[model samples]
Target: MNITLKPTPEIILTGDRATGPLHLGHYVGSLKQRVFLQSQHEQTILVADMQGLTDNAHNPAKVSSNILNVVADYLAVGINTEQTTICLQSQLPALAELTMYYSNLVSIARLERNPTVKAEIQSKGFERAIPAGFLTYPISQAADITAFNATLIPVGDDQLPMLEQTNEIVRKINHLANKKVLNECRPLLSNAPRLPSTDGKNKMSKTMGNTINLGASEKEISAAVKAMYTDPNHLRVQDPGQVEGNIVFTYLDAFHSDKDYVEQLKSQYRRGGLGDGTTKKILEECLQSLLGPIRNKRAEYLNDKAQLMAILKQGSQAAKEKTEKTLFDVKAVFGLNIL
Candidate 1:
């Protein structure tokens, strides 16, 4: 996979909601890429607690408690706190100020038209009583990127529309404010953004009970991998199976060390003699090899919770200092500075 080279180190904005422990789907889909990008770009990973609260507003404790869990996930996955700034979104006041300004730039109808938000609303069954905060989160995300003056946003394909909306706000704000304060952001769309659940559902979600947490115990991971859904039609060990839709093969494609082995397995399965047990065992071994280090790192953080919190606090402070400067400039542009 070729990473596009920027003329200078481009600023990047990427993050996850702190609703639960980061899962395998999260690692393969985005975090793994993020770990690599930190060395090449100016990256900031936001623990999006503020956004998580949009839907879970009634559960403040859930959002607060998981902030560190999400940070731990970041650290365990090799997102170096020294190289990448990881911050809590709610701690940055500039984001709210920028979100407010961007809100005015975007119409309510435009927010309604965002495909990502629309799909989420329908999936969550919040059709009629959509929370206002939830409805405007794309704007908040716009605030997130522009506050950092980020030039690239790593997001899933489903979030392409949200990036479009953010760019629209950037363009509008730049024109209206009569300054090119906000940079137009390009979407770094992941090749496999939406990893399906082991059950072969369209998405792997914590709420859907289809996720393998990054911090899951060896036993837990073994159980989950054992029960993973494979090609249902391949009922017998001798029956020829289709590897195209097999979730186990998908995991292999995403995480395996030897592509040759995966290809051999696929060919054998397609040719009619590969047992599902054999294929699954291969996948389990490949995945365990990949996740073992991450699990160990997570355990270390879990054992030393105080040190983890200190890292988060340090990162959050650094992030706020940068964001505060941007907010001051934005306020000056709008003539809203009171002091």
Candidate 2:
């Protein structure tokens, strides 16, 4: 009798670049999912300092300095270190080797054609001066996902293309080996709406200075909420407000935790009685309440950088074992595992 064993079904891999602190955008989209998924799945969060440098190579300090900041944000958002492994990308040797090996399996044209990489290249105006590392980071990303045999990747719609590219590499590698040497991962799409920048014109981003950081102070939170874009046409309290692009209302919908109350506010505003000041005040209170504890916890974690590093070290050590095994398996398939 012959039997077949199935691969693990729900290992998770997700993380942020070490460029800056996490903001409300992170919380609403990915962090919340990480908090929930950590308990249910085998999860690993990579502080991708290496990927961060693909763009910030000139500012290496930015990446190195924020590695722990990113980890602290993970902890601040309720990702328990014991349940979810949090490791720095630069500390993982196997990921780099896997990337080098996988690069042969991906073409530069395919890399350039990736929608996410293309959009980022155009946004950064790298027109002709695109860094080799920037273009190839998707391969590194594939290495990241497959190293741990991650089967469910948490990502937004814009990131779906990257996952497609990852599976493409997995298929190519498996086909070359003529067996199921690697597991193809799937995207755990976030149902949460994308949080816009406080300016309301773009998505929330740390580089744009238009996001509310998870660790923002009370004063900063108030100022950001007050400065949020609302209906420009509704200049007076008597004028009917447009809720569609109103940043405050959008935020209220995302975080106020009371759908009925938010709907009531929207109805009142559209009927021409609600004022922006009143609306902004409601949103500010919700934000202050939401972020106050996260800010405190983040500060507490940052105070003891030694402990943060220790946590990362422990995660990286465990991650190294998984990634190294994957690397060896791949090399064995290619007949290069002689040593």
Candidate 3:
């Protein structure tokens, strides 16, 4: 009689698309959490170059160029390579294989019904001519999660549907296997609220020119803060200000160290004594201090591209071993493991 050992139950898998340099929104939403989680759990951070290509297939350079930038951003935010396995998605053949197998379990209509997918398709204006890859990337994401047996995935509220889809695949795989071949995962939702774009019109987006990158220079940071959206109704400093939608206070609430002080400012602004310039000045100072060291460290990492590539190569090797084992098990269950 043989008894198989279950994979570790606390592994975490998360990543970013290699589309652009990361921004404060990424830091608050997931990067900061990644830093803390690396030490507590077995974490794998994939630079998702393949997924980044779902929409950028016409411009592959957009994804290829930012692979190192994403990794540098990871290192800058204190994601120690020693603790977190940072691998390039395109380097992991097992993940692609797993994605191929998982794809059979999902259908086009099901993918179309995915709210996240629908929203993305509408936003990208891919309505009728949506790339097959873009429509099916959720299945690929499911493969990424299960390949490492990840049990905790860091995500924002908007991403819960993606995880729901992942677990749906998990259930199908396990049901087909007649045993626990895959582990169901949960979302480690961030406590931080979504950081709005500096313009206050949408979520922070790299394409919109509305975000302050993690690698932003001091001058750029100052300009972005100065241009932050504030209450249009408050034309005078003496007029009562609205704190609810003001981008300055929203940023302060997100980044400033002193919560009590931010609340005080909110109260003062509501009563008509505080000026938007004063709030923007303080927010700028807070952001400058927070991002200054990160910018320097990121530059240091990018300066050594050879070392960065080596790090990714080593991680991909380790990840290959793990994911290959999973692939073997899944295939064996499907009676397709003749190799």
TM-score against truth, every candidate: 0.95, 0.96, 0.95
Q: What C-alpha lDDT does candidate 3 achieve relative to the native structure?
A: 0.92
Comparing 1 and 2 on lDDT, the stronger one? 2
| Best-to-worst ranking by TM-score | 2, 3, 1
By summed lDDT, the worst window of 10 consecutive residues in model 3 runs over: 3-12
Alpha carbon lDDT of residue 33, candidate 3? 88
lDDT of each: 0.86, 0.91, 0.92
Residue-level lDDT of model 1, residues 1-339, one tens digit each, is 999766688899999888889898898889989988999889999999999999999988878888888888898999997789988898898899888877777888998988889998999999979999999999999889888888998887888898898888777767768988778999988876467788886477667778888988777777878888888899888889999878898888888878998899899999999998998888888778778898999888978989988887888899898888878877777788987
Better of 1 and 2 by TM-score: 2
RMSD of candidate 3 to true structure, Å: 4.3
What does candidate 2's lDDT look like per residue over 32-123, in tens digits? 98998888789999999999999999989998988888888999989998799998888889899989989998998999899989999999
In angstroms, give how far residue 167 of model 3 lies from its true place: 1.6
Per-residue lDDT of candidate 3, residues 244-268 (tens digit): 9899988899899999999999999
Off by over 4 Å in 1: 1-7
Task: Report residue 319 deviation for candidate 3 (angstroms).
Answer: 0.8
The per-residue C-alpha lDDT of model 1 at residue 149 equals 85
- Which of the two candidates, 1 or 3, achieves a greater lDDT against the reference? 3
* Residue pair clashes in candidate 3: none
